[model samples]
Target: MNELGLNFLDLGDSDKLPIILIHGMALDQTMWTPQIPVLKEHYRVLTYDIRGHGLSEVGDAQYTYKMFADDLKSLMDYLEMDQAVLCGLSMGRAIVLRAYDMYPHRIKAMILSDARSEADSNETKYWRENSIESIKKDGLENFADELVGNIFCQFQFQEASGSGGVNSKHRLIIFIRGISQPLSSSQMMHDKIVNSEFKIIPKAGHMSNLENLEEFNHNLLEFLGKIEF
Candidate 1:
């Protein structure tokens, strides 16, 4: 409980059922900034830094998405939450799916943004392995700079605005900074968790929520509304 507590950020009313927001790899709760204010108006929102990222202390490098799901379950137990909505992006999405598989009873609904459930493409896996080797040899900073260009749509970077008129440069900057921070080897463990249940968000690159906020929000809100709370 204490270990999990150190990783989460509790926002909005504690009296309400929690809505946990799990961010993608490298990024932290701050990535969910746009959704917080609006979501808090209707539900208690909980966001967290995955272990080894953000304010959370790094855990074992030999971890899987199921382990992350366990962390969420542990956090919910510590907070005394019975069930909550799980919203995730990219790596976060994998965690949510694993959580659903592990403790479906604890999840009221799920929202996966800018993510897929299938394992990384062989090409992507090769790149990830190469990048990890490079990072180990060089540093996270250099690796992050090289990675940013693939994170957002070219139009978003060029227009300086994301879908639905959301500013992307600011988001991109924040994301880059987060990724540039120290990260543990646990990130490589994600490669072991072959995702196969993911659905792609249209017109989104990697940062789907920021890339297509309007559509993402509408789909998210609609899913929330349809669920029997």
Candidate 2:
């Protein structure tokens, strides 16, 4: 735990350049276990459970990306880190964007996988609301079909009240997303955040990281291997 009391797994040599990995919504650090072996050898990799998920304590108030980003900033400050490679997947991507928005200089690079630059889509919002209503009316077991299909980790980049949003593309960005999923919004995201190598993992869906760990790890290492420390 650092400043926010977020349960975290901090590994590798302290002197190494830091690489912070943020997991998707409803996911814990364990989702990143597969990538740790390689990352530990070259970088100080940090993985932490976000609030209300995994082993982290749940906050009393409503959750927001700003709050999540602040927690991350606090942890980094406590660790005395000036900059780090920030990697976020799905919902984690939104948190990453929030942190970058608040402290751009703190982020050295980014690894965004299967994420959008906006909030839940209409279809997603409908199903999400239905799930909530079903749970409230029938309890956890009422709907036993076990919601099929992939629940993607997504995001939307918001801006200040009068400010235009993040328009320019980011440098050192690596975008990896699954090809099986609907990617209508991907072009929009890429257009705004220009060229960063985009790799589509074959035979994978929204949960590309877990679906094809071997391929994901390979691509990730290739990217990290080339980056200047």
Q: Report RMSD (Å) for each prediction in the order shown.
A: 10.8, 6.7
Off-target runs (Cα >4 Å) in candidate 1 are 161-203
Give lDDT tens digits, candidate 2, residues 1-229.
Answer: 4447699888999888899999986568898998899899989999999987778888797788899999898888878888888888878888877887888888887777887766677997797678767867886544434432234323111110101244334447777888776675654566556556677887666777777778888888888776676
| Candidate closest to the true structure, highest TM-score | 2
Q: Give a tens-digit lDDT track for model 1, residues 1-229.
A: 3555456668887776578889987678888887777778778999888876778877656667777888888888988899888887777867876777677777776665554434667997798679868888988888778777768766567667011211222111011111222222222222332321223345556676776666556656655665555
lDDT of each: 0.64, 0.75
Clashing residue pairs in all predictions, respectively, total 4, 4
Residue range with the least summed lDDT across 10 consecutive positions in model 1: 169-178
What would the TM-scores of all predictions be? 0.75, 0.82
